[model samples]
Target: MSEKMKKIIKIAIIASLVSSAYSVRAQEDELSNDSHVTTSFVKRQVAQNMSIGRAVKSIVSNYPQEASAVVSTALDMYPDKYQEIIHAAISAQPMLTEDIVKIALEKNIASCANIVKTAINAEPSYVDFVVTAAANSTPEELNEIVRVAVITEPDSADFIVQSLAQQHPNKIVDILSSAIEAVPLVGEYVVETLLAIFPNDAESVVSTAVRESASERANVKRIIETAQNFGLDEESIYKYAKEGGATDEEITAALSEATEQR
Candidate 1:
């Protein structure tokens, strides 16, 4: 597995454990009084700022360790404001290992990396901060952040693949394709992590991941054939075939099986 994939996955697993630890205690009826501030007050302060992005940065920068709390405040101040700033930051830094890419990409929600890339280049160290915070974010938040960040830095393939392989191998199976070109090492990881995640989509994701340039030629061919013989189909078959570079016969085999099932 690539180092990038490892780091990303590591963050995901860590975030999951941490969130689960607190979720049970945060009952819906239990109103947040201390660390959890209200949203309206945040909006009023954001309005006084020059720009929403700047306003967000001001909070995170000044707070340092409180980046998460500050962002929460910013969102309460302006719902989704934090996401917008993240989008801007990721957009600006395509090459940086945006630890938050998965924050946006989880659960199949499409993200606009172009918008996030704009702010990434403004500061390289911000990459580290985003990565750390992104790791701390909840699964849902991580998914959203990733959906946006992946598109923002679609070129950081190594980071994406390794992170998932080691941390959240389950999720990496599907969405690692966006940056395969930039991080060739991750292609193999994509296949490996897909197999590890072992969800309904694993077969398809693994089949496709094998076709990436980083994939071993023999391994790619083997997975494509396995997918066809196993009878996967539709989006699953499409995904596998898309990556496998399967010939007409191979694709037809998978499609035929899917068609029969339907």
Candidate 2:
């Protein structure tokens, strides 16, 4: 069997054992439901200063369906301990990062940016996954997720932006804008990254950057120049720039600069 399959089977077996133990406790104590039992169990464990990892693992494994509630409860109880809570939860249910992130966001959508950054910080390898989950949980928070994810894990900016762009095809412009806003130094790289992955959205990508950053002549010229280098034709570039809300003056100046660079 594959290593991943074997690992999954092993985890399943362990979860089954932990669940049986908890089942015995539930029956003995007349616990109402898995959700209540898990939440109460986590709160008790935290109160007693127990191993959060073990507590989280046991509850998440035994009550996968209640993982979100359990995680949310843990985070809500320990508002300042989000990193610790997210880390323990992810370590226990590495594959349930989505649920953990979603629950955290649901509990506190205002902190979408911080939640994403913390989740990614817990498991840097899951930057894309974290960003996707945060976006999925709160589509309205896509821009904030993109901004924070890019800022937190700049190394994964390309993947983060591409993932959101692909998932939110209509929000390509906003995704690009948020990403560039997070790391202005990577304005050109952000443009090229999305354009390369979403070549079909060339107009949207180029024009979005131009229109969004219209006031920043350097940013506008830089994106147009990068789009041109990415092989986007000049006429299409100008046309899309206008469509993207770039003024005739801005487009003229940007195109002139792009041409001058060539």
Weakest lDDT window of 10 consecutive positions for candidate 2:
27-36
Q: How accurate is candidate 2 locally (lDDT)?
A: 0.77
- Tell me how many clashing residue pairs each candidate has: 48, 0
TM-score of each candidate structure, all chains considered together: 0.39, 0.66
Q: In candidate 2, which residue ranges exceed 4 Å CA deviation?
A: 1-36, 47-54, 57-69, 76-80, 211-225, 237-262
Per-residue C-alpha lDDT of model 1 across residues 69-144, encoded as one tens digit per residue: 4444444444445457555334433333243343343322333343234334444335434433454444444444
lDDT of 2 by residue, 1-262 (tens): 8999999999999999999999778643533364454456666766665766556666666666666767777776666777677877777677888778877777773478888887888777788889888888889888888888888888878888878888888888889988877776567777888888889988777777766675566777677778788888778987887776766776677667777777
The CA lDDT of each predicted structure is 0.48, 0.77
**lDDT (C-alpha) at residue 13 in model 1:** 99
After the best TM-score superposition of candidate 1, give how far the Cα of residue 124 lies from its true spot, in angstroms. 7.5
Candidate 2 Cα deviation (angstroms), residue 137: 2.6
